[model samples]
Target: MANADARGRLRRPDGGPLRVLVVDDEPTLAELLTMALRYEGWEVRSAGDGLGAVRAARDFRPDAVVLDMMLPDIDGLEVLRRLRGDEPDVPVLFLTAKDSVEDRITGLTAGGDDYVTKPFSLEEVVARLRGLMRRAARSDTRPDSLLVVGDLVMDEDSHEVRRGGDEITLTATEFELLRFLMRNPRRVLSKAQILDRVWNYDFGGQANVVELYVSYLRKKIDAGRSPMIHTLRGAGYVLRPGD
Candidate 1:
């Protein structure tokens, strides 16, 4: 776990500073996290309650989220649902009680990517978030830079995707998942493979996040049109040109 310095600062795939949303009812704790993340050269936003967290997420569009399970309102689990209900399967790191195994289990089962026990160091939080971002980053240097399968096109260098000449807007995480699908074309990517490549965090075998994001992609890429993304029952997901 090397320190993030100005010279070696990590950035988002779009070449912008990484964004993180910190949700905690304690103003002092939230401010400390905010300052630490900012010092690492990333954008930071904070919310004191569940509703505010959801609102902040919409306005901030953060790349990652640091959530506190003990919230002043609505609790952390509900907030996680609200956030996922929106868009972009942003990696969530839950802060929980040190002795509460149940809190840890519930958080991961509810779609949190990772967590840190209370009374933890700020350095640990920063390191964990950095790891998530590193795994989420797109492979920018590709020999095929441009991927084309039928009417769908993806430009890795430009971070752009188009289907049937319609430009499709995607979040950083969505773009990474779509890019993996396009790169493989008709190949069936297993849940394990997708998790390792798309989300490197340990979710204790939890993989519904894959299903959730795929559903999101379908609404945008296949809604009211031929479906290019397909689920193969017992297999995994396969992306092909729509008929």
Candidate 2:
């Protein structure tokens, strides 16, 4: 909720410290998360119910939120839906005991950026939250700039792609997938990882979506250039700067 512009992109004006909201029915867990976030030098607040979570989010306007699935008043998914309705681009990390495939899918489809099952390591959660905040900060800073990889350039703000000065058209999903791949250049990403990171959903029965999107991206990003996005048999996909 914090750093929210008209377009829903997170921004921290005046270079203020990062702020985070922890929403969990368990007061101790909320406090623990709050403490962990604070250890990272972030300002944090906590809430114990859905309505309270919403209110706290509105007032605190955190850069990111760590929400639980089970709540007293409303469900976490509903809370996420409402949050997105108000600020679509707010970064959300679901920290819940709902570890089922369906639950993960529901959380992501509701607009959450990341999901961390309960009983998770505090270090991992903090690292993932930091990654999300970093990405959000980058998005705010370069809202309309072109992301470059070798001779391929993808203009995120303009939704345009060019290779060696030749413009390329891409579908919205293709663009998003490509941007994700480019942003993490050379990092091996499994289909599950790609689905979670790019599609923002669990690949319950939709693992092929990653392959489909990869093909779509290839047609646009590597049609006439060296193959930058490579698929490792039995592994996953990696986007390097060059072949």
Candidate 3:
């Protein structure tokens, strides 16, 4: 049964409990996660292996998933690949003991939405999950709000971007960052703010990843054209139409 905490309900935009699928082979950890999520008044389900995770994901149609990278059956990436085949937009938070930068990058580059290293604080996990779910809910409810700055336009509903009549393909993270920028055009955004909004402050205050992704975005959105994304030297980045 779903937990009924009137004050603690994790409600979706539709006023229903946010459904979460927790996938972990560690039985105790899985139960702990289930309990914690339930305590937030979220509808929670559990699966002990990759195959079961995929099956439960298909059946439950969860709004988000807390997935472990290690699994007994197929591995978490494979399970994620399978789950995404049905619902590509569902946010996924990866849980694992892999603490290396390469491991985190591998998970993110492999289409996982967020990565949480093991030996983590449950509060941090809950905060990250809440952020991801809020992002998803915002996109789902306001998909038609097309963001535009000069010749650049982003259709959040269709997940399409066009610049001066040229189409651009962006990864999910890139799209989200761009969307954030577009929503606040002409305003400089600090690395801290961007980290808080885009990366969820999970990087221990390191800003290199933010710079790296900004460079990545510049190459795609500004290369061979008048740049719309500008670095403000010791300040932050801003999106503005070139004069």
The top-ranked prediction according to TM-score is 3
**What would the per-residue lDDT of candidate 2 be over residues 1-243, giving only the tens digit for each residue?**
235456543346754667888889888888888888888667889899999988888888777889888898999998987776776667888876744656766665555666788788788788667657655655555666778988889887766788888988754345567888888888888898877766554566557557756776786677867888899988899998765
lDDT of 3 by residue, 31-89 (tens): 88888888877899999999999889888989889998888889888988898899987
Q: Of the pair 1 and 2, which is ahead by TM-score?
A: 2
lDDT, residue 81, candidate 2: 79
lDDT of 3 at 115: 71
Badly placed stretches (over 4 Å) of model 2 are 1-11, 143-155, 158-177, 182-232, 238-243
Every model: Cα RMSD to truth: 7.4, 8.2, 3.7
**CA lDDT of 39 in candidate 3?**
88
lDDT of 1 at 34: 97
Better lDDT candidate (1, 2): 1
Which of 2 and 3 is ahead in TM-score? 3
Q: What's each prediction's clash count? A: 0, 2, 0
What TM-scores do the predictions have?
A: 0.57, 0.65, 0.82
Sliding window of 10 residues with minimal summed lDDT for model 1: 135-144
